[model samples]
Target: MNKIKLTITGCLGRMGQQLIKSAKNSKNFKLVSLTENRIVNKKIFGLKPQLNSISAFKNANVIIDFTIPKCTLEVLKIASKLKKKVVIGTTGFSKKEENLIKKYSKNIPILKAGNMSLGINLLMYLTEIASKSLGDNFLSKVFEIHHKHKKDHPSGTALMLGKGIATGKNKDFYNLMGKKYLNKKTFPYSKKINFNSIRKGEIVG
Candidate 1:
């Protein structure tokens, strides 16, 4: 009957703030530490945010990251060294960086996902089933919309859907991945998985 000590990275970012609020309300976790890429002098929820370091994460049972790829790798490095479990919700990692994350997992337990929403996961599941049921005649494309401030095109959720389609087809995700279109009104569905991302004002779709 122990609470998990949690650390959230990029504590000033959107998801980081959301995680802090959610963790504050959760009974199963204690928010032990918060971290950012740079020095943060101000305190959030009675805890000062620190830069990613061994000292920052040495005491945490689990670390949740919602930052960019570089910062996530930094967290992984520290977490791997400290032997801490990590949950990654960051996106926009290149295939090479993705491989490096897998390498980091060899030493420490890590659970990484582009999107962690139940609805999104369910959508991915349904996409997989549909892909399998449709067979070769039907081509597939993933389209998504997000807030304008979000920089990564095709969004992580869109990519997740792409992976689901690949899984259903029994193809490698990287090999099956096709074009990524941003702010486009139209796109084509090829033999592989294609993606279209629409960025608008303040819509979390």
Candidate 2:
């Protein structure tokens, strides 16, 4: 059987490194390219990381990206022209950026998710169910903790959960969105969904 050619963007990030390790172990994929936002002089897994460009991704069937919203958009532009599929695991995009992604999807295949884990997806589903079942009698808020290096507050998974709450209430997530508190010991639940994010040690959760 022929292996699928793969390109990994943001190759220096935690998820990027993890993808590399997994791709090397998997029999279904062949890692064809690695790209970074900046110049990388050293070689990883026998391939030098290049900047996100048409040439970098031209040889791959699919590209997996886990980076900032700006970098993810850059990758999408290149992928759209190359006609390659993209799997986006990046988060913290504003409503406008989200719409931009949707626009790009009309040209090529794009699979995007806040949290890719099955367990997290299940939790999001349950959240929506609970929010709908509970009704307006109760208020909802989201809390999350991640590694200190993670820049985005309220993590993507947290936002997903918030969106779930909005879906249950049958309202827009942005309109239902409340305050975003970082590293707060205590926070209040409001009519609109509030979020509290805590960044600490290198915990992957």
Candidate 3:
């Protein structure tokens, strides 16, 4: 069987490095290209990282993205033109940006998820069930902790959980979204789903 040609964006990011390591070990994929927002002088896995562009992703059959929202959109534009498949692991997209991604998907195949882990997906499923079981009497809130280097408050997983809550309640995720607290000792839960994010240490979850 032929190996799938793969390209990874945000080559300097935490998820980017992890993808490179995993892709190198896996037999099902051949690492073809690596891209970053800025120029990376040194070669990684014998391939120099390039800026996001058509040339950077032209040779790949699939592109895996774990970058910021702006960078992810940039990659989508290039991949759409190239007609390349994409797996989006990036998060923190605004409503407008999410709509934009939906528009791009009309042109090419796109699989997007905030958290790609099987465990998280299961948790999201359970969350929805629990929210529905609990009904509207119980208010919902989300809390998350990540490595100090991680950016974006509430984390994507938290948002996913919030979405599950919204889904259970049969309401829009954006409408039920509440306050986002960063590094707060304590927060309150309201009618809307509040979120508290703690960033510290080197926790990988």
In angstroms, give how far residue 162 of model 2 lies from its true place.
0.4
lDDT of 2 by residue, 160-193 (tens): 9999998988889999999999999999989998
Maximum-lDDT candidate:
2
The Cα local distance difference test for each model comes to: 0.90, 0.95, 0.93
lDDT, model 3, position 196: 95
- Least accurate 10 contiguous residues by lDDT in model 2: 131-140
Runs in model 1 lying further than 4 Å from the true structure: none
**Model 3 alpha-carbon miss at residue 87, Å:** 0.7
- Each model's TM-score, in the order given? 0.95, 0.98, 0.97
- Name the lDDT of candidate 1: 0.90
| Ranking 1 against 3 by TM-score, winner | 3
**Candidate 1: minimum summed lDDT over ten consecutive residues — where?**
131-140
TM-score of 3: 0.97
RMSD of each: 1.3, 0.8, 0.9
Residue pairs in clash, model 3:
none
Clashes within 3 Å, all models in order: 0, 0, 0
